[model samples]
Structures are given as C-alpha cells and as structure tokens.
Target chain A: MRTIRFLLQKEFRQIFRNRAILLLIGVMPVMQLLILPLAANYEVKNINLSVVDHDRSAYAQKLITKVTASGYFKLRGYSASFKEELRKIESDESDLILEIPQGFERNLIREDQQQLFIAVNAINGVKANLGGAYLTSIIRNFNEEIRIELLPPGRFNPAPVIEITASNWYNPLMEYRFYMVPGILAILVTMIGGFLSALNIVKEKEFGTIEQINVTPIKKHHFILGKLIPFWVLGNVVFSLGLLVAWLIYGIIPVGSLLVLYCFLSVYLLAILGFGLLISTFCDTQQQAMFIMFFFMMVFILMGGLFTSIDSMPDWAKLVSRFNPVSYLIEVMRMVILKGSGWKEIWPQFGIIALFAVFLNTYAIINYKKTS
Target chain B: MENLYAIELRNITKTYGREKQVAVDAVSFHVNKGELFGLIGPDGAGKTSIFRILTTLLLAEQGEAWVEGLEVKKDYREIRKIVGYMPGKFSLYPDLTVAENLDFFATVFDTTVAENYELIKEIYVQIEPFKTRRAGKLSGGMKQKLALCCALIHKPRVLFLDEPTTGVDPVSRKEFWEMLKKLKMQGISIIVSTPYMDEASLCDRIALIQHGRILSVDTPENMTGNYPGQLYAVKADQMYLLLKSLRKYPEVLDCYAFGAHAHVSFKNAFEAAPLKAYLRGEGLSEIEMKPIPASIEDYFIKLLKT
Candidate 1:
C-alpha cells in the first residue's frame, strides 16, 4: 500500500507537470460537452415544400393550407408546372412537391376517388422520410374531415376509430439533449480515463523507465493500482465537469440520487481504466497503444447506444454492444438521470460493470510481467 | 558461504529472435561482497543483457544465478528489495523534477530520501541546486548524477549500473567513479559496465567480454601483468607506414595502433637497437622504441585476438 501511494504520487506529478496534458484534461470535455450535443440532434425540422396545383379547386387549396399549417414544412411558393417544381428541387429550394392534377375535384365527386402525386427529394433521407410521413398523416386527417362534412346528419353511418396517445415518460418534451448529455458524458469520461492510462505504461516503456520499475520489489498489484487510481480519479473529475456543464447549459438534473450516480461512476471508471492498463501491458509503444485505443473507442462509442438506440440495432450489433462496457455505463447514466431509477432497477448494469472492473484489472495485473 | 559472494552466475545463456541470435552465451562469474566489478566490452557485447538478467528484469534461457545467495529466478522478490539497477538508458521520468524523481524512487523502496540521505548525499548534492529542474533539461553529467542518486536512495545491498558513463564527459565520469568508490566503502557491492577500457582500471576486478562471451576475468593489475611477451611502444615518422612495416616484421607477434604510437609485442625479447636500426633501414626516420608496462586496454586487445 505504501508503494502504491508513492507510485500514485509519481504518476500524478508527471501528469500535472505536463502543461499540455493539463490543458487537455481540463478543457477537452467541456468543449465536447457543449458542442457535441448541439450537433447530434436527429429531429428533422425546416423542410421546404413546393406545390403545383392545376385543379385550383377548394379541395386543393384546403390541402395546401393544411400542409403548411402543420408546421413541419415551409411553402416555397406555387410552381406553374411539375417541370418548374422539379427545377425548384434541382436548385435545392424544395425538399417535397405536391401536385394536384387537373379535374381532381371533379374526379373525386364523379368517380368517388382522386389521385395526388408527391415527388420527394430523397437527398437527406431522414428529412425526406419524416416529411413524407408527416404529410401523409396530415392528408389522412384532411380526408376524414372532408368525409364528415360531405355526410348528411340525417343519413346515419357508423364507423369505429381507435385513437392512440403517446406520453414520453422520462422526458416529456422529448428533448434530445437530455438523453445526449448523459451519454456523451459517459463517452467523455471513458475517453479521458482509457486513453490516459493506456498511454501511461507505454510511455514508460518508450522512455525505458519500465526497466527501472520492474527491478523494484513493488508488487504487480501495487503498480496496477497506482496506475488505475490516478486515471480513475481524473475520469471522475471529467465526469463531474461534464455533469456541471450539462446542468449549466441544458438544465439537466438527475432525478435519481447523486450518490447513486457517483457510485456507478466510480465503478465504471475502474472498469475503463483497467481496460486501459490492459492495453498498455499488451503494447510496447505509445503509438501502438494510441491506435489500439482509438480503434476500440470508436467501436465502443458508436455501438454503445450514445446516438442510436441499442434496441433498434441489428442482432449481431446488439450482441456485440452487450460486451462493451461503455454501453453499460450509458444505460446506467440514462436510467438513473432520466428515469429516477433506484438500485434495484440498476443492479444488473452495476453488477456487470463491477465484474468488468474485477476481470479487467486482474487480467491486467497478471499480464504485467515482472520478469521477461 | 552464501553471504560471501554478492552475485554468482553459472553457465548463463540467452538468445533472442527466431534465428536464435545468441546475446549472452554460456558465461559465468561471481563478484565478492563489497567489491567493485566491471563488465568491460564494446557495444552489442551483451553487457546490458547480463545486467538485466541479474537485476531480475530479464530471464536467462539456460542458467542458474544468485544474488546475495538467493536464487535469481525463485527469490526475485526478495532480491528486488535489496538490489538497485540503473539501466543503460537514462530512464527517469523526464517531466518530473529531480527532487520528485528522487522522492518517488525512495518512496517506492518503502523508504524516504531523508532516511537514506547519507547513502546518496555525495551524488545528490551535486544536482540538488537544480532540484526543481525537469530531469530532461539537465545536462548529461547531471542526469547521470540524478540517476545514481535514485538508484542508491534505497541503500540496496547490491547496485547494478550498466554503462553509467557511456555518454558522459570525462570529468563527470571521474566523479562518478569516485562516488562508486565511496559507496563501496560503505559495504555496498557495485557492478558497473563500460565500453571505455580506461574505466576498467578503476574496478577491483573485471570480466572482459566480446560477442556475448567472457574473454578474461581478473583484477586489472593481474590481467595486464599476464601479457605473455615483451611489449614496446614504437613511434616513428609516418606512423601509419611504421605500423604496417612492424606487422610484417619476422619477430613481431602483435601490432595495434594506440593513439599516436604503435603498441608492438615481439615473439622473443630483443635488443632495442636492432629493432630501431631495422625500422630505419625500412626507410623510417626519427624511430623511437621503449619497453612499457601493458595497460588494461593492451590486455583486452590481446584477449580478444585469441
């Protein structure tokens, strides 16, 4: 234990002595926390729509008014022809074009049906799909209203309809930032903890200091602990700073106990830092360690359900995410901060992370050979 | 009997890579307690490999070794506690200040600088004025002192310094040897390696090695004294030509250029007048020849030749 204390002292001194590293540790998370959430939003708004109404009937005008009033789109002005609308789309002025053919109202009354055409620009797929869906729903509602107006009150007709109402439980407004802040916080902490500790031992190897340390009587476990603790502490500091940034910028306060959040953070850091040390033990140079860490970080973050829901991923991806420690931490962060979850609710995630902490740290220590 | 020797190796052999390049061949030697031993050889002589194996930083493929009577492989943990190793490279933390590096090493051995101040005082005082300076910024000589200070902070029973003066200035190299002598006086066993043959004379005993093999092991005096034939320092006008002529001479056994003179040995003792006259007849002018005592370098070159 005394040996570990000295080692920790040395590690911390080296970390603080490097001015560039100090600035990076203090500033990187704050910038990422502030900027990444703003750009990560998936809500598609401000779609531009153009209409070509050849019928010039009341029905066509009403449809146009309704589409514009739904607030999902902005009218770019009526085009004279379908060719003109296509030109508008080609010029990047419109994302969708609705055309009401000639005699459309006459056909609806005489033949009891009419066809309308929609040309959607599929360039931005998400925006195009969501816009098309929103327009379909609005037109469906307009059709129901027209049917109600056309039927006489005395003529009785009965049709059953089912209404579904959705209420987002944790985030009532469905703000993406609320979900994103915690997830991003998880990634940031993992990065700081993982990369720093991964580089630590490799740096020693490059500098030839490992020879000096290996010759010492210090226990392997003691050396691993010394490496793990400093970075773990730094990871927590980054976590807290991210939380503060979340609270200050987005006004996101955890509904669950702060004690629970810190509890999970502490254990999560152990798992991540242990994994870092594991990489360090396997690599002989800082460059190799950095590349390996980068590869794993990309895999862990992209598949960790930070931006996309793990439930929606393919079977293999979801299975792989199950093995990612970052995924577990992201789940715990969302559950506790957004759902006000208690220990009983988060115990499984905590258990897995605790297991990772034990497994990875033990593996790292065992792999760190004193004699070679 | 166990405590009499500070280090012992028996037929230690180490090879590296798929081709099995032999780094340290079947070699063995021992250093007595409180003695200053040197492994004198040029680069790639496997000096660092031997030091690493003895310090428990490496494993010998085939050998049995002991430090202070404790088996190297089995008793590495206990050995680590009593052994201090300064590797061939300057391995201290570069960003860390000198004082911090010392404090860290001291604390790592479960001791404090204050507790073992006397052990490193002579070396530490030289760099103490720049205690706050980062180790990387220190001069090569200062860096050597700081490394030595860190190595001795624990007051180990045995200290292993591998090429500690390889790149250092001569003045600092002299000071480093003086410090080693002082450490030896306090009953610490010191084993230092160097490529500089002049440094060999400073050791109580040395093993001259080449190509991963031990050529000779003896006290410097005895090693030099064991030179078989009479030796001469011969200098003449056009020294390069004189060296070639001496090698072709019938009586000449060995001829090597040793800084401004050709160190020549003869197969049999002969009068200087004949050699001097013979060199002049070979179209050499201002020929001078004198019998001189063989130095460690002379003995080393002789051993390497055989």
Candidate 2:
C-alpha cells in the first residue's frame, strides 16, 4: 500500500509539473463539451436550393412555394436554364436544384401527366439522401391534396390508414446534443486515464529514473498501483466536470444514483489505465508510446458508438464494439440520463466493465518485466 | 574467513536472445572493500551490461555472482536494497523538482533523507538551493549531482555507475571523481565504467575489457609499466610530411598520431640516432625527437598487439 501511495504521488507530481499535459488532460474536455455540440448536429436545416423553371407557370410556382415554406429547403437562387443552375450547385453555391419542365401545367391539366426533376449533391451521402427524401415527400403530399380536391363533393368516403405514431422513446426529438455530450465525456475520461499514464511511464524511462527505481527495495505491485492512482482520481474529476457542463448546457442529468455512475466510471478508468500501462511496457520511448496510443484511441472512438448507434452497425462491427469499454460507458450514461435506469437495467454493462478492469490490469502486471 | 571483497563474480556470462549473443563473457573480477574499481572499454565492449547485472536490473546467465556476500540470482531482492546505481543515461524524472526526485527515490527504499542526511549532506548542500527547481531545467553538472543524491539516498553498500562522466565537461568530470573519492573514504565500494583511458589512473584497479572479454586487470601504474617496447615522440616542422616519410622506413614498427607528437615504435635492432639522421637528410628542419614514458593508450595498443 505504501508503494502504491508513493507511485501515485510520483505520478501526480509529474503530471502537475508538465503544463502542456495538464492542459490537455484537464481543460480539453470542458472546451470540447461546450463548443462541439453546436457544430455536430445531424438534423439538416435551411438547405440552400436553386431553381430553373423553364415553364414559368402558376403550378410550377406553387411547387416552389411549398418547398420553400417547409423550412428544410430555401430558394437561394433562380436560374434561367438547367445548365446555369447546375453550374451554381457544381460550384458549391447551392445544395440542391429543382427543374420544372416546359409546358408542365398544360401537360398536367390537359394530358393529365406531369414531371419535375430534383438533383442533390451526394458528396456527404447521408445529408444528400435525407434532402432528396424530404423533397420527394413534400411533392407527394401536394399531389395528394390535388387528388382530395378532385374527389366527389356529395359522396361520403372513409378509408382506414395505418398510423405508426412515430414516437421516439427516451429522447423524443433525437436531439444530437443529448446523444453526443455524454459520449464525448466518456472519450475525454478514457484519454485522461490512458494517455496520461502511458506518457508518465515513458517519461520516466526517457529520463533514466526508472532504472534507478528498479534497483530499489520497492515491490512491483506497489509500484504499478502507485502509478495508476493519480490518473484514476484525475479521470473521475474530469468525468464529473463534464457531467456538470452537460447538465448546465444541455440539461442532461443522471436519473440513477451518482454513486453507481462513479463506481462504474472508476472501474472503466482502471481498465483504460491498465491498458496504458501495458502499452508503456512495450514502448521504450515517449514518441513511440504516444503513436501507438493514438492508433488505439482512433479505433476506440470510432467503434465506441459516439457518432453511430452500435445496434445499427453490421454484425462484425457490432461484435468489435462489444469489446470496447467506452461503448459500454456511453450506453450506461445514456440509460441513466435519458431512461433513468438503475442496477438492474445496466448490470450487464457494469459487469463487462469490471471484467475489462480486471483483465487489462492483470495483463499489464504480467507483461511488465522487472529486468531489461 | 571472509575475503574482504566488496563484489565477486565467478564465471559470470550473460546471453541475450535465441541465438545467444554473449554481452558479458565468462568474466570474473572482484572489488576490494572501499576500493574504486574501473571497468575500462570502448562502446560495445559490454561494460554497461556487466554493471547492469551487478545492479540487479538484469540477470546474467551461466555463472554465480555476489555483492556484499549475497548471491546475485538468489538474493536480487536483497541486493537491490544495498546498491546505488546511476545508469549511463540521465534517467531521473525530468518533470519533478530536484527535491521531489530525491524524495521519491528515498521513499521507494523506505528511507528518509533525515535518516541518511550525513551520507548525502555534502553533495546535497551544493544543490540545496535548487531543490525546488525541476530536474530537467538544471545544468548537466547539477543533474549529475541530483542523480548522485537520489542514488545515495538509501546509503547502499555499493555504487554501480555506468559511464557517469561521459558527455560531461572536463572540469565537472574532475569534480565528480573527487566526490567519488570522498565517498570511497566512507567505505562505499564503487564500480564505475568509462571509455576514457585517462581515467584509469583515478581508480585503485581497472579491468581493460574488449569484445566482452577481460584483457587484463591490474593497477594503472603496473599496467603502464608492463607496456613492452621502446616508444619515442618525434616532431618536425612539416609534421604531416615527416610522419609520411618516417613510416616509409622499414625499421619503424608502429607510428600513431599522439597530441603534438607522433609516437613511433621501432624494430628490435633499430637505432634512434640513425633514424633521426635519416629524417634530417630528408630536408626536415626544426626536428625534435626524444624517448618518453608510455601512456595508457600505448599500453592498451600493445595489449591489442599481443
């Protein structure tokens, strides 16, 4: 225990001494939480659109008015020809283009056939698909209105249509902030625990002091435990600060007991820190340790379910996500915050986190060599 | 009866990897209690490997070793308790303050600065003003002093220093040796490794190692005395041309550029005066030639020859 205390004290002293590292570990999360949600939203709004109405008829104008009124698409420019409007969109001046064919009203009323064209840039395929779907739905709804107007005035007709109700369970609006803030907090905590501790051990190796420690009477368990404690505490502190920002800015709060959340976070932090120590054992230089860690973090954050739902991913990707501790923590955080879940609802996630903590720490201890 | 030896290595050999490259060969030597022992060799000569093995940071295969009467393999845990090791590189945590580094290392051995205050007081007092200073921010000399302090905090029975004076300025190197001498008086057996041949004189005895093998172990005075051959330093106005022309003589055995003079050895039957005349005939002026005492480098070169 004394050895653990000494190692922890040494780690804290070292962390406090490096100003750049302290800023990275402490202030980075808060800044990310405050500014990132504003830019990360997925809901497409106010999409600038261009129109080329070869037929300047009343019917064509009505379609334009309907699209503009829906708020998803705004008419930013009107071109005389299809080529001119295509040029605008190609130059990134507009996101979508609408073309109304010539004699469209004559065809629709006399011949009973009408056609229009909608073109959307597919560079960001998701946004383009959503925009295309939304425009098509508006056009279909307008056509149905005309059909309703044409129905017999005296005859009473009633037909049954199935309704989905389309209710979103925990987050009614699926607001991006509610999903992102908690996950981002999880990433920040994991980084503080893993990256910081890995750098600490590598720094000692570079400085030659680790060699000195090897020739001492200090026990190995004490040394390893000591190195982990400071980062573990610091990880929790950052986690809470992030929680505070989530509450104040996004009104996100846990319905579950604070104790349970901290307990799980602590175990998860231990697993991350142990993984860092294992990485440290394999690296002889700080730059090497940092590079390897950056690679692992990339994998974790991408597979961590921060941006995409794990359930929606392919089977192989979902299986990979099961091994990701950050994914579980994010799930638990969302459950507690949005679902107000307790131990029974989140126990599976907690068990996996505990297993990760024990497994990674044991791996670190076993791999660490007393001699080089 | 105990042999009064501070360290004893019996056929110590260390092999690394599957193919087994011998870093330290079947080498054996001992340091008398309170004596300053030097391991002299160039890079890749396995000096650092030997020191690391003695310090308990590595295990040497194929032999037995003892430090302060404890076997290295069986008693490494106890060996760690009684040794102060300063590795070849400056390994102290650069982020921690000087005081913090000292305290951290002292705490590791379950000892306090006050407990061994007398042991490190002289060295610590020099850098005491910089106690709050971060170790990385200090000068090379100050860093070495702090490293020494951390190593000595536990008041170990022996000190293992691997090239501690390398890359240090000449003046600091002298000061460091002086500090080592003072510690030696307090009966701390010190084993230091260096490639500097000049430092051999500072040790009570030195083992000249090459290619992981011990060439010779003796006092510096006797090693120089044992150098076989007559050596002469010769200089001319045009020294470069003179060296080229002089080596052409069949009587010359070896001619190497020593500072300000070329140390030339002769064939067994060669005469110095005739050689001097031969050089004078070659139109070299301001010629000065004289026999001089052999240096450690000369001794080592002779050993290599044999």
Winner by lDDT: 1
Off by over 4 Å in 2: A106-113, A153-158, B1-4, B14-22
- DockQ values, each candidate: 0.74, 0.78
**Cα error, candidate 2, residue A173 (Å):** 3.1
Chain B structural similarity as TM-score, candidate 1: 0.98
Measured against the true structure, the TM-scores of the candidates, in listed sequence, are: 0.91, 0.94
Could you tell me which residue pairs clash in candidate 1? none
- Residue-by-residue lDDT tens digits, candidate 1, B224-280: 889887788989989888988898889899999999889998888767877788888
lDDT of 2 by residue, B111-230 (tens): 888899898999999999999998889999999999899989999889999899999999999999999999999889999999999998999999999988899999999998887777
True contacts kept of 2: 0.93
**lDDT tens readout by residue for model 2, A12-70:** 77777679977886689889999988777888887878999988888888888999999
How do the candidates score on chain B by TM-score?
A: 0.98, 0.94
Most accurate candidate by DockQ: 2
Evaluated on CA atoms against the true complex, candidate 1 attains a DockQ of 0.74
lDDT of 1 by residue, A96-194 (tens): 998889998888777867888888999998889998888888888987787777777765357656789999999999999999999999999999899
| Model 1: residue A213 alpha-carbon error in angstroms | 2.1
